[model samples]
Target: MTTIEKALIRLHEVDAQSRGDFLLQTLDARAKVIVTIAYIAVVLSFSLTSFSGILLFAVFPIVSASMSGISYGQVFLRSMIALPFIAFVGIFNPIFEREPMLVAGDLTISRGWVEFLSIMLRGVLTVQAALLLIASTGFQRVCRALGCLGVPQIFTTQLMLIYRYIYVLINEAIRMDRARRSRSYGRRHYDLSMWATFVGQLLVRSVGRAERIHRAMLARGFDGHVRILGHLRWSSTDTAYCILWIGLFIAGRFFDLSSVLKFL
Candidate 1:
């Protein structure tokens, strides 16, 4: 198959997975959305000094990714790429204010260092929460959830458009990469100018394609809003899940269970 065709097939596979009827398929989309948000809120509320608490909370993403059939390695790789930006912005806490605040037998660490570590942990927890949310819930369901939550129609529509086009852009980039490789006889060459040219061409093509898609939407009676068919129902299972996690989060935050464990 051609590169574009292969890319299209892969896109279809992802869509199928998103819409698939399976074991957890019966779970209400709204419940998942609410629980996912609640999960993030709980994770982010952790005390910066609470290492064990953060570690315990990490199970959510790991389990969610595994259960969703999404590759953990892929999520990790994406996290690695996206996380450094946050780290760089937050790492300054450890750089200045070098006064010794805590003694660890032979070494003294400053309060600044502690704060910086807390910031780093916060970033990881927040990012992982978001990653799990997207991977498990899928973009379409997320958009629907957002709409139900009273996010403006324009914003939801824009989000939907972006989600739909992201795969298209990815496919375009992959096809371009494949074409480049074929033309170069399968030799890996990093030509900056050529890459820039290819990206420019892809951007132009994507814009043109978006125009065509817009026209197609108009032809099908899309008048600034697309009706989503699925209705969101919150069930007993969702309520239990939310309450359990929220209770755990509150207990962990207030009780400092990790510190108690250390004393044991």
Candidate 2:
């Protein structure tokens, strides 16, 4: 199978996770989205030097994965996609801020290093929380929930469009790739020139395809708004779930539970 085919398969597998009959899958998307946002806010609010406090927040993802029946390994691997950019953002912290924050006997640790690690942790946690939210609640539901939460209609509609057509984009790419291979005559590798030509072809084809798709949608009475199928009702269970998670997040953010336990 081609690499693009593999990518499409991987995408389908990830999407399938959101459709399972798991605990999180059954919750209201609005509640899950709200709690995920609250959790991210709490995570970002932590001080750079509060490494221990951030460590404590790791429990949220762990417990969430356990309750939702999501695989930590898969989530962790997917979350690593953001690591390179996160590293780029903080790579210079150690060089710019060298004040010592910790002393272990003869060894000294710099504040910049701590802050860099803290930033990395924060980025990973936030990204993973979002991934979990998407895995538990499908992207369409999340977009609908965002619409209900008063987000601008255009933004939500664009998100839904991008997500819904990603498969079409991939399938188109696969077809183009197969055509390329068939005509490449014994050449299996693409040089820079070939890659450029391939990209140009794909772009032209995509634009034409998009125009046809828009026309078809208009012919079928397409409106500006995306129409989702199900109703999103906020039940008592959703309220309780939101309250429990957000309350925990607030307590963790302000209380410094790690220090309290030490005093006890």
Candidate 3:
């Protein structure tokens, strides 16, 4: 299948997962959002060299994904998209700090390397947590939850629009690609000028399409607020869920559970 088709399939898969009857799917979206935010904050609060301390944070995403029936392999594979950039951003750590942190049979590992690894681990964990959230609780619900949590309406609205607009953008690109291929007459590649023209045409088409979409929304009483169907009732289960996870997060952040276990 084509790239766009694959992307659309992935999008549908996430939607299906979100709608599935699972542990997290049953909880209020606000609870999930708040817990996710707390998870990220705790993950980021670890020191650069405290890799072992931060390793405990992985439990949150792993348990969450498992309870929610989300596939760990899919989340890990999808989260790899951010790995290269994360690696690039941390690649210089080894050069800046050469102090030996660990010694194993004459081989020495530097503090910089530890820091780099810690950064990489943190990024992977946080990305997985985010992917799990979107897969478990639909993005629309998450955005609505954010707005309800006092996040600016404009930001949440734009985030929702940008997410939805991606499908439209990709569909438009697919149409343009098909047209380009049909007119290429067996010629595989287009010149720079032709590619530039295609880009400009795509932009024009996208703008026109967006305008039509906006008009349709306005016609349907499009208020600036994001309105999801049904009320978000925070039940006792949601309260327990939030309390349990947030408490775990706080404990994980302040104490090295691994060390405590070792001592025990």
What is the full ranking by lDDT, best candidate first? Answer: 2, 3, 1
Better of 1 and 3 by lDDT: 3
Error of 2 at 57 (Å): 0.8
lDDT digits (tens) for residues 95-208 of candidate 3: 999999989998999999999999999999999999999899998888888888998989998999988988888888778877888888977667999989988998998899
Model with the higher TM-score, candidate 1 or 3: 3
Off by over 4 Å in 1: 1-26, 46-53, 63-78, 184-200
- Pick out the ten consecutive residues of candidate 1 with the lowest summed lDDT: 17-26
Q: Write the number of the candidate with greater TM-score, choosing between 1 and 2.
A: 2
How close is each model in CA RMSD to the real structure?
4.3, 2.5, 2.4
Estimate every model's Cα lDDT from 0 to 1: 0.71, 0.88, 0.88
Residue 219 accuracy (lDDT) in model 3: 94
Q: What is the TM-score of each candidate against the true structure?
A: 0.75, 0.89, 0.89
Residues 1-264 of candidate 2: C-alpha lDDT, one tens digit per residue: 877898898778768988888888889999999999999999999998888898888888887787678988888887888999989989899899899999999999899999999999998899889989988888888989999999999999999888878899889888878898999886777899989998888889889988998999899889886677769988999999999999999999988899987886
- The window of 10 residues in a row where model 3 has the poorest summed lDDT is 224-233
Write down the worst ten-residue block by lDDT for model 2: 221-230
RMSD of 2: 2.5
Report the lDDT tens digits of candidate 1 across residue range 1-264: 555567577557556555644423446666667666777777677655555676666666676666667666766665665667767876776687577778989998886777676666666666766765665566787788888888999998899888788777887787688878788975675489887888889989988998999899899998888788758777897677668766766776677677777877
